[model samples]
Target: MLDYLKKSFARKKARRQFQEYSHTVSKFILKEEGEIAFANWNNPLVTPKVISQEEVNFFKKFIPKGALCIDIGTNIGDTTVPMALAAGKTGTTIGFDPNPHVYKILEENVKLNRDKTNIAPFPYAITKDEGEFYYHSSEASFGNGGISNEIVSDQGAFQLPQKITGINLEKFLEKNYRALLPKLSFIKVDVEGADKEVIGSIGNLLTKYKPVLVAECFTRATSEERAELYNIVADLDYTLYYFSDFDENAEIIKLEGPKDMNRWKTFNFYAIANAE
Candidate 1:
């Protein structure tokens, strides 16, 4: 074991090198079950990105330990696993992902971390309703983590069979708000370009739970479409916080007036919650 660890850490290479030996990486994490599961770009389905120190601390402050956390784009359980750890044995984590390739690896990581008991894995995409959609599979395309491009497959972005788990977030809240609500802590949404739909579905919960929302906004979206989304959240009365990357400190950003409608290429994340 000592020798293996030494060898694995001795030679450092490009991030993609781990992709060649994904199985090996899987084995390493799987060897110790119940330990915190962590993954990187090698996983392909979910790649770990550097989050800002302030953001980490923010979660520490607001995301209570042993609170139920929901991960929308679980990918490979990067945030899901940590959420489980943060919640501890008493807490529960629910992860949702539609990509079969990513879901398989997410389950593997869940087992690798021995979080199967604490985390419930859902293999489906969270959309406004149940319906068919297309996804892109690209090894080269970076960013726009969710379904950014059109359903059309090109440049190796194949349109695989996908079904949206028509989840009326409001209804889910009405059903589980009392029975399963866990302090209703942190919520992360990075579903490519479907942010509008996902948020729309959770209209009531956003108001009831009032959890800190980490949402990714597609800057390239049409001016009108962006305005609609901004208005939806505005009506909810959430203070917007911007996070370009996880590691930087979150800054308060004012939303444009109801009439200001302009399109930008920068994707901004808003950390919205009650003022007090």
Candidate 2:
């Protein structure tokens, strides 16, 4: 164990030798898991270990092999990669994140699996409205956030701003991936506070395909807004499930409706369509 740790640290130190990005990117590889590149490697969202068998299996429950999946707010492809694997090589996993720093790494991670996993990443936010989108991040895309309408922030300090292109995923998919709509099996959304907006925008898809959904109920949002977020899914006839943290063995809690949120403070959850 001691020798393995020493060699592991040595390899990590060696990999950091060529951080060729303004945000200082690093490459980390977990023996069999392949390579993962990230700006803030410590951020749980980009860590390689987060894609354990349990995580992949969790997604496997909702995602069939050769089915289509989507990951919104996919910072640097950690969750995206797992979903891709669960969907198998023939399937496609699409990830969207407007933060360039992390999106670059997201692209790199996708390339690492070019021969094995089918992942297509886009640098557009899944917004409902039509407007100029601006992404501001103090932590260089390591944490949660969205390409919001405003460029300025009252949150204070180091909010590096970048203009981002926005698109409605439902409309975009209807136009581009129209034929693949039947294969749409899952949609994961964790855009900090804009989870509701993304959920609301895909109302048509949710009603038509009724794919399993994973979304977050952010603490920053008002109770009314949170209720509406769940209501959107509930009204679409999907059962809701949540886990407080992304533990490998995390057990999901089922929510009958928005009121169940008061008892379990988990921000993230899975929503499956109800049977006919």
Candidate 3:
């Protein structure tokens, strides 16, 4: 009876907040776990969407054996685990996710695959500087959001009150993952909408290592922002491939130039540095 009343009250309050604020209330406590999850944006019902998948095989084909890889915004370690496994026990896959709610689950998943996969999880947002900053959640609910940009929804208050530190990815890797730099052959960035900033912060590494890059051009981002993503990678001599789905078999639309990007929909794109 007590638990029922409590849950009933919570639901009523949630509805009230949704109606009043427009954006769903951000709930920080998240429970349960899944092998895979979709880090969707503007979801008021949940922060990270969970689904069942016994195996993650999409990244194995992209990640070479015994090669180092990195996954930014690794919600629940879904992509991170596969990258780690693909890299083999001899290699390492470092994942960075600042969302504490999901980061906890990622940490647990990392442990479960420790025996067979080399994984490292960090609860920090990737940025150009090493300092504390605000982490905002747009259209959030019970734990979901993308990027720290102050994008307001139809609801009044979309930015949640949370602080996450920014880590200089290049410096962090140089200081810690130095030994593995030579083997850094793959990098995947799915940080909502800050893909370019993350890429820019590590520009030197990308230039030096010339790793395979996979980044999401977020649906909420502006056209210029998406175009810049193209310019950044193209300047580095990468051939771009855009795909709508995460499936390895999904049809790919090759991007010939900046004008070809269709930002009306959400998509993940990949690029390979032209072999020197």
Candidate 4:
């Protein structure tokens, strides 16, 4: 009975917040003057829409204009907008997410940033192979971006289930954009706990393409898994950088300190090519 009450309270709260957000977005649309004013500005899951100006500047500096950037686990495309903005009118930003509910929001977000010349939103997951996989429902949290079947819960807040088609990063890149391979300049991967698999699957692409990578390596990754990740990155001859603090609110920082990024933390790094 207690648990039931708690869930009921949670549902009520979620509905209230969603209503408030709906009002805010409606007002903002009415006040604004643009071609795409009807486009929604809120994330599918209410992950706080707070991004630091400094972080935006960092992305703009690291990601080149006219370069192709692939964002894995793009959730509802919040990051895609800023990335597309950073890439400017000439660049292409591809956002991939398999969750059907979130993919709808991702599509909406792409429309929101329609002024951004070349942004493509794909409803797919970049994994080891082409197959069907289950996606956990996002419970209005940014960390709930994407979850595998093992971590999904039916009775809990996450109740949505999605069967997604996966793609091997290397093979997908070759098949879809073989001629434009050289233009692939940066990649931001954050596929929940499947980071290792995603990184491993794209090993050849990283080594061959040499694109700058900013991956979200949050907790839940084992030390050995982290080591494996490091080795793979090292094999590509790429240098790593770590963010100072990583939390829902903690901004992604580009460290300028003396400590070598490899030794600091298991996660949070900007792996740049040796030549660049």
| Each prediction's number of clashing residue pairs | 10, 0, 2, 0
TM-score of 3: 0.77
Show the lowest summed lDDT stretch of 10 residues, model 4. 23-32
Local distance difference test, each candidate: 0.58, 0.73, 0.70, 0.63
State TM-scores per candidate.
0.70, 0.80, 0.77, 0.73
* Of 1 and 2, the candidate ranking higher by lDDT: 2
lDDT by residue (1-276, candidate 2, tens digit) is 999887676455433332224333455554544664434344322334344556666677888889999998888776887788788788989899877666877887776655557988998888886456766543433344455566566432234344678888988888888888899999999887778778889988988998989888776677687788888888888889877555447777888777776664447888888999
Per-residue lDDT of model 4, residues 1-276, tens digit only: 999887677565654342223312221221122222223434333534543344444667667778788889887665676677667668888888876655676676666645644678887889776887666543542225454545556423453444667877777778887776788888888877576678878888888889888775656566666666666676677766676532223445454432333344456677887885
Q: What residue runs in model 2 are displaced by over 4 Å at the alpha carbon?
A: 1-49, 138-143, 244-249
Q: What is the lDDT of residue 145 in candidate 1?
A: 34
Question: Model 1, range 1-276, lDDT digits (tens) per residue?
Answer: 998666555333322232232422322222222333344434333344432334334455555667777888887665676556556566667788876656765777666545333777886667676555555544422212345334555423444555334355555655755676737787777776677778777767777778777776665567777677677777788765544454335554555543333433645556566575
Measured with C-alpha atoms, the lDDT of residue 75 in candidate 1 is 75
Question: Model 1, stretches more than 4 Å misplaced?
Answer: 1-36, 41-56, 115-117, 137-157, 161-165, 170-178, 248-264
TM-score of 4: 0.73
Q: 146 in model 2: Cα distance from truth in Å?
A: 2.8
Q: What's the residue-level lDDT of 63 in candidate 3?
A: 76
Global fold similarity of model 1 (TM-score) = 0.70
RMSD of 1: 7.2
The local lDDT score (0 to 100) that residue 248 gets in candidate 3 is: 52
Error of 1 at 231 (Å): 1.3
Off by over 4 Å in 4: 1-45, 51-53, 137-159, 245-267
